[model samples]
Target: MTSFQMPNSADQINLREWLDEQSRQLGFDGLRITDTHLGDASERLNQWLAEGRHGQMEYMARHAQLRSDPGLLVPGTVRVICVTMNYLSPVIDFDQEWQRLAEPTHAVVSMYARGRDYHKVMRNRLQEFALLIEKQIGSFGYRVFTDSAPLMEVELARKAGLGWRGKHTLLLNRESGSTFFLGEILVDVPLPIDQEEESHCGTCQSCIDICPTQAITAPYQLDARRCISYLTIENPDAIPVEFRRAIGNRVYGCDDCQLICPWNKFAQRTALPDFAERHGLGRASLLQLWSWTEDEFEKRHEGSAIRRIGYQRWRRNLAVAMGNALADEAVSEVDKDELREVLRNALPTSDEMVVEHIEWALDS
Candidate 1:
């Protein structure tokens, strides 16, 4: 944690220019800056939690102070930097696959995971961004992260004028919308701060309407327990029976809300191919994905975000999708029978939660 000291009076380095040059060379699409202030969100967060909107993702409550107070996480921090990169079109057919889920006969994976793991991609890029800063300012107290903790990424981004936070709680830019990932570098350089932008959600509620589980309880308020992302990736237990059928063909994650977002119309594709999908995940069939064993899951998801759910959740998700596919009138008897066989064999070796899901799938 080495640091460099700089005079308090600002000089004419044109931070915007240096930032643009460094980020462009480092292969970044965009950057924005914000003051350390977080706006009225602190009160809103308190109200959201007082209503128990967070649900089982208790970790959200633990980092409340660190999330709101940047100084608590990095002492002497005066400026926040935010960055975004388009992760759209990693798998070309993902949107089409999601559309197919309407048939209840196709497997639906979240659009974000249709490609490689973003954590690896963003973390590496954030580190690179940090390096660029160090090169300019010499040694400086800074930390880089992308969704690594409860650091109020969207709030900080909006504060930096990166973009406005939409009703869905994602940072949105006029040019890029919210289809990209947000990363940050906390620094104590006392850089001239940027103004926070006004929110643009303005009478729009598409995200709330599109959620299958009604996870967005209200504007900017989310109930994680009902969120498909939480249920599939966080819970690691039997999905509540009420929401299983509504979960549809989504095997790993859900992006219905984001897909329906108006802002995403401006979402761009990446120049970096590392975000590209491997193993045909964007259009994988229920039977195709369900056939994977523990070893297969491990190998296929090697550097992909899909690995977070692990083999157990993988099977659990595929079983639910297979059940949906099996029950669909559009599927062939041969495919249905094959799906049944896969579930039948998988049941004997599964834990109780998985076994219950498998049973539900079989019944479907």
Candidate 2:
């Protein structure tokens, strides 16, 4: 933590504009300021937690209050500085992305997780921005967050005029679409706030209609239990038998909603190399990723977000994808035969969770 310096009246008047310029120089795509209050979000959050929509992500429940009231998380935080960074790699062939997701042999890692970990990337950049703040007007009470805290990032960003929440529940901007990561700096400085942007979703339900698992049960409502992203990344148990076939070859995370959204046509490519595809994960085959030994998994995913799931969840997800691939008529008989042999071979050595998924794959 850096030392804090009190800001003068002139500093307060000009800080927001300076912060925006410096933030852009630091590689953030968008930035806005807003107060710490969350209005009715606290009540809505309470209801969501009570309904258990978060599935096995108990942390969402445990930190429910702190998330809605930013002041509670960082005392003296008068305003929040929200920033957006696009992560869509330039090399992405938008036309083939959906086709790859439906292909049984190719694994579809979520667009965001295919590169270096955003948690590190965002946190480092936010910290650098914070240092810039200290240099301009001295250090103030502030805390940086990059999807690493209990804060309601999407809500805060929406409040800051960064974007509006899409029907799929991710932040959507007219310029960047919903293919960006949001980070925040909770600060004591009372910077002028930006006007919130209004929703532009209209009657378009493309995201909801396109979700493979129908996880977005209603507009702006998501049952995480049915979300492929939640199932593949957050839920640490068996891949539910009901959703396995629908999961297809998505071994890690899901981006079907964003891919099908019309706004994605305007989605910008990331300027930072830290978000470029690493280890060829964007196009890696299920068989290739499945063959990684524990040591290889550790070494390959050292700086990648997918590594957080560990070997068990990784292999379990691959097994489900392989199972789906085995049943896919689109896959060649040779690939199905190879997948079967691989699943059978993996069964004997896998832990109970992975073994069960492997058996299910073989049955498929």
Q: How close is every model to the real structure, measured as TM-score?
A: 0.92, 0.96
Per residue, candidate 2 scores C-alpha lDDT tens digits across 1-364 of: 3355446778655766687789889999999889988889889888888888999999999898789889999988998999999999999877889778767799889889988999999999899988888787766789899999899999999999998999999999999899899999999876778899999999999999989899999999999999999999999999889999889888888888988898989999997999999998988999899899999999999999999999999999999998888887888999898988888887778899999999998888
Highest TM-score: which candidate? 2
lDDT of each: 0.78, 0.89
Q: Residue-wise lDDT of candidate 1 within 1-364, one digit each (tens)?
A: 4566654444435656788788767656778777677777877787777777776667878888778888788887777788877777744543575577775656777767777788788889789888877887788788888888778887887877888878777778888777778788888776666676777778999999989989887887788779888888887678888888778788887888777888877777777777776787776777788778789989988998889878888878777777777777888898788888878988778988789899998898
> Over 4 Å off in model 2, which ranges?
1-14
Scored against the true structure, residue 325 in model 2 reaches a CA lDDT of 85
lDDT of 1: 0.78
